[model samples]
Target chain A: MEKKYEFLEHTADAKFRAYGKNLQEAFANAAIAMTNIMFDTEKIKPLLNRAVDIKGDDLKSLLVNFLSEFVYLLDAEGFILGRIASLTINKTSQGYRLAAIAKGDKYSDKYETMGDVKAVTYAEMEIREEDKGKCWVQVVVDI
Target chain B: MPKRTELLKELFEEVPSGVGKGGITKLTKEELLDLLEKGSEWSLENGYGTKADLEATEESGRMKQADSRQVSERALARGKPQLGTLGAGNHFLEIQRIDEIYDEEAAGVLGLEKGKITVMIHCGSRGLGHQIASDYIEKMEKKYGYSHLPDRELVNAPLDSELGQQYFKAMCAGMNYAFANRQMIVHWVRESFRKVMGTSEGMSQVYDVCHNIAKIENHKVDGEPKKLCVHRKGATRAFGPGHEEMPEKYRKIGQPVLIPGSMGTASYVLLGTRKAEELSFSSSAHGAGRALSRAAAIRQFRGEQVARELMAQGIEVKAASWKGIAEEAVPSYKDIDEVINTTVKSGIGKAVARLKPIGVVKG
Candidate 1:
């Protein structure tokens, strides 16, 4: 029930900082922060669960690919995200891989749609771990 | 005369201006690839616009280097259903009238007459292009690694390297998709006018050019001519007069650069200047950038208030939701008049005419 994310001031795009007790929570919060830019996450009823498995060159790549999956779903399949049901990040022999299930409903007129998020950029992106084991992920999206 | 509100509603419904997916048409993967390869020609062949429209388009709406094979399956999937959709964000469709003409000859050549209505559509490759950039960033980082990069987003492959060429080709295809997307919308705009105003005649395209694109073009560097891959990121290519790459009619006047403003503001049409070649690789600022974030805009103003204010000013605006209107409020952007004046004074472009929005449809 702690603070998950807060919006940051940006000139042209949407910027946010998400927090979690650990990396999994931070990554999950980051995904929610992104979807919140377009629609209200609370309003999205979890009508379906999507399986996500993706590999990246490193932790940063893993985080990006992890979040980008939701963009694809919204655009290609009209899936509106509610929350990250479960997530795990594993260190692979090559690099990092992410597996998770995203819970959301198919997009419909019931949702209050705003601007579209074009893509997630690595611009000013940060992943930090602080004392007491709190992890924070900062992201800037091209809307 | 048909009511402006009626036409605005028709355009809003016809253009699919929302975050929801699926455009006016759905394409199979193979058919989508062909559209990417052919660009606006595919749109025209399908009877979207006239032959004159293609001639007025930059590169005639096709990039020869584009190969759909270079595009990833993921990009294709996202792009296939979005060919004719007007996407959300700063993208828009406006019915504007020539409010001011600074250069008489230039305005005459480009067919800008006082009080004449013109349709301006501002958009890009949508989800397809977004995935292409994401895919290449992941692919390039694996090969080149981002340990030394000042910005991870700047991670790039060598221009002549295999990976670089592959991304270049794929990016070109994305540009093609945008060209075709706008062309199809042009068709819809014509159709909307015919349905509402009862005549689609004299609705001809003036010019269409890419806002952000990296191209291998011949330019002088340090006083010596060289072929450079000029990446005009967040800029519009403002090639000067006599540039052979421009349309035959435009070669005498230079390319027509279209700059769309935020909701309830004025857009501008500028002619390319020769000095731009020497100043900054023949590029000009694309639009009046955001002065405030979407969150701040929403927190400060409601969409209903924004719509009502514009309506009071005799400008009719339509969008999917009130939240959409607030995010694009006119006060949330920098002074567009100042931006246009800066471009003209900097000598990169010449002010041809200023356009005032009479009706707008936002995504």
Candidate 2:
């Protein structure tokens, strides 16, 4: 198993650096980092799934929208995420389109929800392939 | 006030069940749309609280600028369900005891006294507000391309631009949602008190203030009054005595600024000072302010241990998650007393009353 993401220190909110072999993996890992912040991911079961489709004018915006959909599901539907089944990203003429199958379950009494995330802020949002064959994305969420 | 144990039990039992769900109170699309438009006015008209409560709220519980049409469909979808919820992370509803009075006259005006019990509700517009911000951030970044900006988070549109005005209207709707959300919680609290104590006496609101907001107000700049868009993030509006917006009863003393502290810590009630209007734009610190990240706090303390410590101090703790408790340990936050001292020393606000929590319910 590969390391997905790592949490960082922020004065007023939660921050994380997610890693992947490529952009799709990086976005999926970012979702994991965010959900893991709320509770122990091991306790969650991938019993249910949802489709995520987001459009952005650029790669950065694409990542923000992708993560934003998870935040929305959690708040609106009480859906807590477990794992990412698959993700596909394509560059379109206008911008970008990301389609993903997110696996998770409805938040239930059995799980201890650590925190509620407000938004995936653009504060420190950035993507880089600092090392060969690896990509890194940084994001700070307003809790 | 009822006995501490009884009060705490009532609060613990009465808080709406489940963390994220909107509780038993269901709202149709039309009703939620109305709430986004009217804010606390909807709550008042729906009989959630009294008009006096609105008078005590910032903007009188309604932002006339709020245009529900400006809110995006995605934002509305996220907000429609979470309308009356106690959001997770740091948000809470606490029953506290007024332990000290710094300004006797000011405290009297705000209905504060030593040993008086009070309820403090803290929450926001929930997913609706979050989605609106997410939607606009991408919009602004796409339109302006903020690569030159120091941080992408600083991406913004000119306040007078069409996109800027649209975001403003949507943000105002979000603010209104928060105002109405808090108002609904207040109603549930009164009912909770009545259920446990057989009466809702002493549950009257002292004041309700919004910390995160942008306001259009008149302020003197260079000896001339100018209308400015004042944005207070992580800060509260502390309008001093005689401000035209303050309630008639508070105009003589000053607007009430409720500075809540982390669980198991002391909270303060401060009154706006004349100095604030001159120096800090009539704004004061919102909380003790998070000094430690949640991850660091979790590593340093156990949630159960923190809960035990608070219980030993006679503060009852009820939360949906223990990890949530560990993440909000007292050591994770700056000292309330010290923060309040800074506010007083800077003359941004004057201390009026101090509160110690007896009961706390966190999401």
Q: lDDT for each of the candidates?
A: 0.89, 0.85
lDDT digits (tens) for residues A78-121 of candidate 1 = 89899999999899898998889999999888887877888888
TM-score of each: 0.98, 0.96
Best by TM-score: 1
Docking class of 2: medium
Model 2, runs deviating above 4 Å: A130-132, B1-13, B17-19
Off by over 4 Å in 1: none
* The candidate that achieves the highest DockQ relative to the unseen native structure: 1
Model 2 pairs in collision: none
- Candidate 2, position B2, lDDT: 46
Two-chain complex of model 2, DockQ on C-alpha atoms against the true structure? 0.69
